[model samples]
Target chain A: MQRTTMDLWVGLFVVMGVIALMILSLKVGNLNVYNPSQSYVISGNFENIGGLKVRAPVKSAGVVVGRVTDIQFSTQTYDAVVTMSMDSRFLFPKDTFASILTSGLLGEQYIGLAAGGDEAMLKDGDKIMKTNSAMVLEELIGRFLFNKASEDDSL
Target chain B: MLLPRRLVSGIQHIGHRVIEGVWRLGVASRFFILVLLKSGTSLRRFNLVIRELYFTGVLSLIIIVVSGLFVGMVLGLQGYETLQKYGSESAVGTLVALSLVRELGPVVAALLFASRAGSAITAEIGLMKATEQLAAMGMMAVDPIARVVAPRFWSGVISMPFLAAIFSVMGVFGGYLVTVVFIGVDEGSYWSQMQSAVDFRFDIMNGFIKSCYFGVAVTAIAVFEGYDAPPTAEGVSGATTRTVVTSSLVILGLDFILTAFMFRGVS
Candidate 1:
């Protein structure tokens, strides 16, 4: 009886542990967000990909469909190259537009996709020809000031 | 001349202490390997490990749960206050979950385990040694390490990650209770935002790995201190104190090194 009681307690302990791990993975962490079972990679080139980072969400109409996998600079063209892993379930047309967008006034950045009415769909390893760069806060402010100065001159 | 002589002796004393520390570390490493080698017996018997698990893991559950909930609640309260200033109180769930999984869960749980269970293991073994129980087993041609120490060591190694996981889960729930129920944070964003922020492979797996290492380190230190304690009452007491102190310092140092490697700009 003593031995049986000990075994029962140990069994209970192990069960609790398994349950805790399940809770951590499912409820607390994003274990179910990006299923990698069927995903394809496509690269995009931008003139100035400001403040964009790898693993940033790739969203379509506010729904996340992929993740930014890699970011590199192309020395030859002086443009930033971003490789994205897109879910196979959501295919984009060849002329899809990829733009870097910030969530809030000062929050994380993500890639937004807008599909064009192209007959051809983008395949794995295909390059996204049309790309929009992230908006640099400093550059935006500088341009605003310059426009204000130009308006004053015109006045 | 006198001051110069004193300085020279002080330097010598420091050097001596360093060498002694290195030598003790070597001894501990050897003991750790021996315990590992003898662990087959514990695995084969199985019941031995279960008993130790009850003592070390089950007994520590109440404290781990209570502390985890309080820690999570505290994180929620403080995180809300800070994020509320920026009108981003919804991010409190993200903060609580990330901190608990990435650092506090494994680190704090290990610290508590080291104090509660680690000290008990050391005290038990030290008393057995003081009473010559180990020696009595040796007279019967039994390997005391394989019979006595290996079970405790394996039990600790197996139990640590579970305790840490439970702690982190409880902490997240505590945060939810405070932020969602009491503080009136939006329920949907509180969970959805956290889920988006925390990655299972990166945050959860890394935290699990950290707890496993802590378990090995804490248990190894506990058993080593107990086995090496001079067979006397004062000696046993001193060894118990040393086990807690050394385990704590090692846990913190290992945490820094692990964090530097694991979390360096991953986000």
Candidate 2:
């Protein structure tokens, strides 16, 4: 009987510990708490996503205001379309240009919005018209090397 | 010419031994699986296995939790020191969470359980076999595999994932406590960084899957060695040692294989 009670207590503690960890994960991990009715989705087109994964933060002027919810390729244009769900409080203007920006030299990619001072706010299902796609680091390096090689050839 | 011939003969002898060992292992594995399946219907066996899991997996929770806490703290401290060099101390949460969820948590919990549960199973089964209790059961129309081996296998299969989960959670909290309280990371930023760093798609399911495999390897090897015990005290001791060593190696090897398979596309 004593062993049984001890077992029960241990089981309870283990269950509670698991629950607490999961709760902490939810709380700390900042998993999306979706309110379908209130949230607005806006899409941005990018030539290359680079490391712009889903759930990467969407920051406006260096302050994170939303997250990247989905990424799909436009079959016709052969470009990536990233869907961002912004908090209802921060209304984006239609002219706001979304750029795929890297946090640092070797850091992960995130969507950065440069908000424009416009009267009209972007509604759900609207596309951000002007977009700056991900800058391919390798391409830049290639261009620099190519220019250097051409200069050497000229010499 | 004589030396070359002797060396060739030696190599051939080793090859033959290797094949014989592999054949023996194959037969043992089949027998083990059959015994496991047959034992499932016996209420006494079922109860014994459940009790073993409770003792082995559930009771080991305190040790897993304490170890997890220290692991998280150490990771956080080390990660923070390095990140601070780059003025990116906020990334520590990401570092800790990713490390704990991806590798440390499952591996540590498994090793801990292996030492505790693996040793116990080996000794208990080996002692039973050594004392002719196993033979007595066989005489009474009772199958030892069905009665003994199955419960340990199932217990391990069930308990490992639960223990791994517990380890991961505790480790995360340990990191959080150190970072938030000791290191002076703001509660909001610390948590936000962890959230953004850990994607459910990336870490959670893989960790659980790895733990399940570890459990299976640990239990199977331990029980196999126990069943193969010679009828002597020294033989039981040797079986216990082999059970621990073999199970640990198999667990690590399987972990590497699983990681390679899971991360094949990513890296």
For each candidate in turn, the interface RMSD (Å) is 0.9, 3.4
The whole-model lDDT of each prediction reads: 0.94, 0.80
Instruction: Encode model 1's per-residue lDDT on B45-73: one tens digit a residue.
Output: 88899999999999999999999999999
Number of the predicted model whose DockQ against the real structure is largest: 1
How many residue-pair clashes does candidate 2 contain? 1
Window of ten residues with lowest summed lDDT in model 1 chain B: B1-10
Question: Runs in model 1 with CA error above 4 Å?
Answer: A1-3, B1-9
Residue A130 miss distance in model 1 (angstroms): 1.4
Candidate 2 clashes between residue pairs 3 or more apart in a chain or in different chains: A29-B195
DockQ, per model, reads: 0.84, 0.28
**What TM-score does chain A of each model score against the native chain A?**
0.92, 0.75
Tell the DockQ for candidate 2: 0.28
Model 2 share of native interface contacts: 0.24
| Residue range A1-155, candidate 2, lDDT tens digits | 22576467546755765674475447544445422336788898888888888778798877767778889999988999999988787898779988999998778899999988888999988998899888997999999999999999999
Superposed on the true interface residues, model 1 gives a C-alpha RMSD in angstroms of 0.9
